[model samples]
Target: MARVLMYTTAICPYCVNAKKLLAQKGVSVEEIRVDQNPQLRTEMMQKSGQRTVPQIWIGELHVGGFTDLWALDKQGKLDGLLQNN
Candidate 1:
């Protein structure tokens, strides 16, 4: 499986949903909590170009937030992304 990383906040529902979805896929996520640190939040925004709680990355691919991830899964493309780089 690909390495999954997510930039998230403590109380964001989207982050929770994203984690749950990834859990269902049996994929481990490296979560970075940006709620406590401004630098990490800046890094996430710079990397993803989005000021969102759940900024997701599958390997080197930026998969956006939970909605984007869900869309990918619905399209049946998420598994391939998880398995491939």
Candidate 2:
């Protein structure tokens, strides 16, 4: 499996959904709660170019948030990405 990192905030519905979906797909994600750490939030924005909560990175690929992730899954590309292929 690819390295899955999520920059999330506490009480974020999208983040919760994203996690659930990834879990359902059998992917274990490393979650970085930006609400608890300002530095991580800055790093997330710099790395992803997005200041939104629930910024997700699959391996080295910036997969965006819940909407982007679901779109990839809908297109059947998420699994391939998760496998790092």
Candidate 3:
């Protein structure tokens, strides 16, 4: 199983949905609250190159935001990314 890391805020619906989807997949996520810690938001921007909540990472792979994640799942590529290669 791959480790999941999500940079989120307090009230992001996409974050909530992403978490729920991951939970359905039986994957535990490490939630980094950028709203509480401002530095983390900077780190998220640096890491993902995106200024958005729910910046998700599957191990070392940057999976972009919720829409990208959903696209991967729709394409049947998310499971392959979650598995250990």
Candidate 4:
């Protein structure tokens, strides 16, 4: 399984859905609460080039957010990503 990291807020619906989906895929996410730390949010933006809650990374691969994740899953690409790392 790949190491999953997510930049998230305390109360985000997309984050919640993203977590739920990752869980359903049998992934345990390392969640960084950007809402609690502004610096982390800045880091997430710098890392992903996207200022959004639930910026996810599978190992070194930036997976964007919930919609991008869902799209990957739909394309049957997510499992391959997880398996690679």
In terms of lDDT, the best-performing candidate is 1
lDDT of each: 0.96, 0.92, 0.91, 0.94
Candidate 3 residue lDDT tens string, 5-46: 999998999999999888988899999999998899999999
Between candidates 1 and 4, name the one with more favorable TM-score. Answer: 1
Highest TM-score: which candidate?
1
TM-score of each: 0.98, 0.95, 0.96, 0.97
Off by more than 4 A, model 1: none
Clashing pairs in 4: none
Candidates 1 and 2: which is better by lDDT?
A: 1
Model 3 spans with C-alpha error above 4 angstroms? none
**Candidate 1 positional error at 4, Å:** 0.2
How many clashes (backbone N, Cα, C below 3 Å) per candidate?
0, 0, 0, 0
**In terms of TM-score, how similar is model 4 to the real structure?**
0.97
Question: What RMSD does model 2 have?
Answer: 0.9
Off by over 4 Å in 2: none
